[model samples]
Target chain A: MPIPDHVLVVDDDPDIRTLVGRLLEKNGFRVSKVADGKGLQQLLEKSQPDLIVLDLMLPDEDGLVLCRNLRSRSNVPVIILSARGEDMDRIIGLEMGADDYLGKPFHPRELLARVKSVLRRARSLPGDVQEQDANATYRFAGWMLDVPTRQLYSPKSKKIFLSGGEFALLRVFLNHPNRVLSRDQLLDFSHGREIEPFDRTIDMQVSRLRRRLGDDPKKPSLIKTVRSSGYVLAVRVDRGGESHGSDDSGPGD
Target chain B: MGVEPDKIVVQIDEDLAEIAPGYLENRRNDLKHLPLALAEGDFYNLRILGHRMKGSGAGYGFDGISEIGRAIEEAAKQENRQGVEQGIADLAAYLDRLEVIYA
Candidate 1:
């Protein structure tokens, strides 16, 4: 038999930590619960987990920063839990490299499916954002995307990191530039998971990308929102060396 | 397993708190501390305690405690002393009915 996946749940609320632990344990996942990010760091130093279920509003440090740092170091999946369904929170959480997001008051089953999906996705690379390949770098708009090392460099040649979500979105845009891609299409291309009922996480993620790429709200330079047809990236994508002559990738094909 | 000589059977009631308490004896230390905590205008502690109660009470098969806990959490949020007091009174009344085995 295969060994059960290990999951670290970090949340300030002890009741929630305990309840999530019980639920995950019942679902055949070995679970460990911690109160805050400090505890999370301590646990990580000793042993790595297959996945992390993180809470956004922690007592000491913010979870988004933690996710960014985690992604910078390893591809270990992080699923964020947020009580606030605010767009900013969702956008920032995903842009920070969380594999998935679950709002508060969610059924345990919802979380379970996400956990399984991410773990399964991590094991496979196709249609998955976190593909590890050396020498596969995509450079566009003075930002260099190092695919293998999972690092992004700024226009000034400084090494700036991109979250898993941000990297995935950027790759999707790089591959299909100068075209209007709908939110549903973006979700399917990047995360490849079903948008549960009324989830608008893709919109938030796009907002985060705009902010990070310094796309101005008024008279934007990089990615522009096309009235009612999602968003379009205007710049040409250079696969490290060669530039695509034509936008063969049509709007909706 | 015999009773000690010269030891008389005595019954007493005390304020206390509990965790998954099935009876008064298993009550938690909050039984005694909650009133004092409230009297000192410590709604923050009350809020934390109430949140714990609200989350765990129902799981432990104490829905009455959960209801009182909800009241305490909401009252603490607004810093409403009367609601907190009423919640404490309800909690005390319910606790009083929990029979404990002295042995």
Candidate 2:
């Protein structure tokens, strides 16, 4: 028999945790519950869940930082839950690599839909992370992206330093190669917390990424900017390699 | 699902059996000590309790509990001393009268 997908929900409020737990269980997923970030880590040490439903206003640590940290290591799909439903909050949550975002006073049915949607997308690729890593190294435009370490290797074999925000944006673009990602879509994977409609923040990150990749902003070939819309990673990404299982799994509510 | 407040039945899911009892116990204890907070005029602490109740009650098949909790939280937030007292009284009266059944 196939194992039911496990969803670990991390929240400071026991009520919310339990409530979400009930909802997820009713939706045909195995559910584990935790009250704080600490509990989340402890659970991750035991096993990796299929997806994570994270709450932003944690008592111990900032959820966005936790999301970024999680992204730096794994491609685990995360759905952020926050009471702050402002556009800024949603953007920041997405920027932290949350695959999806929802606000409090949220409809339980909506959360279930997002849970299923993310799981479907994540599973569309090989359902196993180990299998993915075996051939998931994306190489494009003379740059090799090590998904596990989140390290960018230059043509000179030197490690390029990338801010958490920049790396997140780049990852989002890479995952959706050749696709025109709008500013709102860009916000889903960058680390900016401020909110504005199609602000220059994404542009700045793109410019920074171009410089790091040796792609000139004036004649950018790697990440091309489309007028009045968004940007696209124009190069084909190559993924072929032997794979290994990840020894670490991690986060909390 | 019935509005028979006297026969208020919280049909906690069987999966939550272990924790539901604890949740009820905790709320009972919280409600027990709430008078102390009210007498001390610690609206902040009172508000926190109400907030938890409001969020948890409906999630666990206890809409009535959540409604009372929301009222308490709102009163505390508004800092209306009279409203806070009335809310606390209402919560206490409900808890005192309602019966708990495990489904």
Per-candidate interface C-alpha RMSD?
5.5, 3.1
Docking class of 2: incorrect
For A152-239, candidate 2 gives per-residue lDDT tens digits of 9987788998766667667776665665666766774442423233554777878888888888788777777777668877766665
Candidates' DockQ values? 0.06, 0.17
Clashes of each: 8, 4
Kindly report which residue stretches of model 1 are placed more than 4 angstroms away from their true locations once superposed. A82-97, A101-110, A121-130, A135-253, B1-33, B53-70, B90-103
lDDT of candidate 1 over A151-192, digit per residue (tens): 878899887656677777777777556656667667766765
Highest TM-score scorer: 2
TM-score of 2: 0.54
The TM-score of the first chain in every model comes to 0.51, 0.52
Candidate that scores best on lDDT? 2
Q: Could you give the C-alpha RMSD of every candidate to the true structure, in order shown?
A: 17.3, 13.8
- TM-score for candidate 1, residues paired by index: 0.48
Over B57-81, each residue of candidate 1 has an lDDT whose tens digit, in order, gives 5443455666787789789989999
